[model samples]
Target: MRRTSLHDCPAPAKLNLFLHVNGRRADGYHLLQTVFQMVDHGDLLHFDLRADERIVRTTDVPGVPEQGDLIVRALLLLQAAYARRHGHPPQGIDVAIDKRLPMGGGLGGGSSDAATALMAANALWEAGFSREELMALALPLGADIPFFIFGQTAFAEGVGEALLPVEAPDCWYVVIEPGVAVPTAAIFCSEHLTRDTKPVRITDFSRHTMNRTDSTGFGKNDLQAVAVSLFPPVAQAIDWLSAHGDARMTGSGACVFCAFSSEAEADTVLQQVPGIWRAWKAKALMHHPLNTVLQVSAVIE
Candidate 1:
């Protein structure tokens, strides 16, 4: 059976339970550790396979040009990788993205979009790349890209590449997007950022202590200080949410979140949300939507 298009393929957003900057590597990339928790919410992309070699995106993704768009780049990279493996380029593809999540909100929206492209292209083209191969192709695009490919709640280290699956408590979140675009590079490069926070074992992040706002808990996102100092909206959002529960910035900034044990609790916070920010009640996903589609057992052996 031949398929013409793949639709409603979701590329969900992720929250950094806590991000810590240990030190700068010799290569200048920051070394860090964090837990990545996928949310049931995010962008959706569709693809229509083309017969000829003309890659196109059917819709405009604001702020990203066609050529530089990560989705387009993923398709091109997969084609190039296939050409290297075989003798010719694969068929072209048309991508359509229903943009939902906010960009620069530290939600991994773009990277998730890129991951979706790679997976769809692999299936649409019948390329048969292993999970490991797909992740390799993802890395050159973005650090978080590979994690989406890996597709599970994980404790990540080493610039967010290394991963160990973690059991994040089944919880819901009240995510607030402050409508400010954060510059991740600028925040990481800030002279005022914390770089030497003592590392904690992943086991220490057990469910019982995960909600603590103290120093030893999943207490802080290391970049939050820098992000708050630079983006007032992020700070404002955090403060507003804090009136209900402990809230903190995720990833590098521009969005803040607080966790609740149940959907109703999260929704209560959402109802009380101020008109200034966009708030969502999102559930944490145990795995990526594509987790079962790709067989990775072969790569393990």
Candidate 2:
């Protein structure tokens, strides 16, 4: 039997346990080193195959046009990549995103959605592309997309494409979403941004086991200060959450998170979050939930 759809595919969000800016490239892109930790809370996607080579998005995502949506772009990219290799385009797909994660909250929502679309499209189209191929194909779309395709908690470098799987502590996180969108480009281009933070070796981070009792936390996010200064809501959220523990802004800004030893500890804080902001508790996921299904997809007819 031919499978025509892949429903309820998860596109889990990620937290930058710590983000450091190493330097700037000749291309003006900032070099970075970050540990991306996958959290269980994120968006979901559904893919339905089409008979013709007409890519479409079945659902409307607020603020994201159909053509500009990363999910649609990912499908187009994959289709072009496949056509270049196989001399023929695969069938089109209709992707519906169950958008849950906050936009521009440093949660990697869009990039994660793009990665899931690529993975699910490979399976439904039976493109037979390997994980490495998919990662490479996904890189041009966004730096964070490859990390999601890597399907593990990873230590990432070089514009966040180079990846090495690392062990992340099994813990829970209480994330607070400040009602603001922190633009990534704006944060990176700011004169006050820290471009050189004295890069640390992987061993430096691997030595620290994150838990409730560990007082000496890992490296701090270098972009936090800039984001905090630019967004007052971010600063307020962090100031409040820090009372519970060491809370820091995730990637660029607008979301702050604190790690706890148990779900109960996280929930206690989640319940106390102010009504003005959105909050949730999620367990740390060492690997992606859909990792098992991301094998070499075989063509089905």
**Best candidate according to lDDT:** 2
TM-score (C-alpha, index-matched) for candidate 2: 0.95
Q: What are the runs in model 2 whose C-alpha is more than 4 Å off?
A: 210-216, 293-301
Q: lDDT of candidate 2?
A: 0.88
Full-model lDDT for every candidate: 0.85, 0.88
Tens-digit lDDT track of model 1 for 59-108: 99788999999999988999998888888988899899999998889999
Q: How many clashes does each candidate structure show, in the order listed?
A: 0, 0
> lDDT tens digits, residues 125-236, model 2?
7788888899898888899998898888888888999888877788899999999999998899999998888888777778776333321278899999999999999999
Worst 10 residues of 2 by lDDT: 292-301
TM-score of each model, paired residue for residue: 0.93, 0.95
lDDT against true structure, model 1: 0.85
For model 1, the superposed segments whose C-alpha errors exceed 4 Å read: 207-217, 292-301
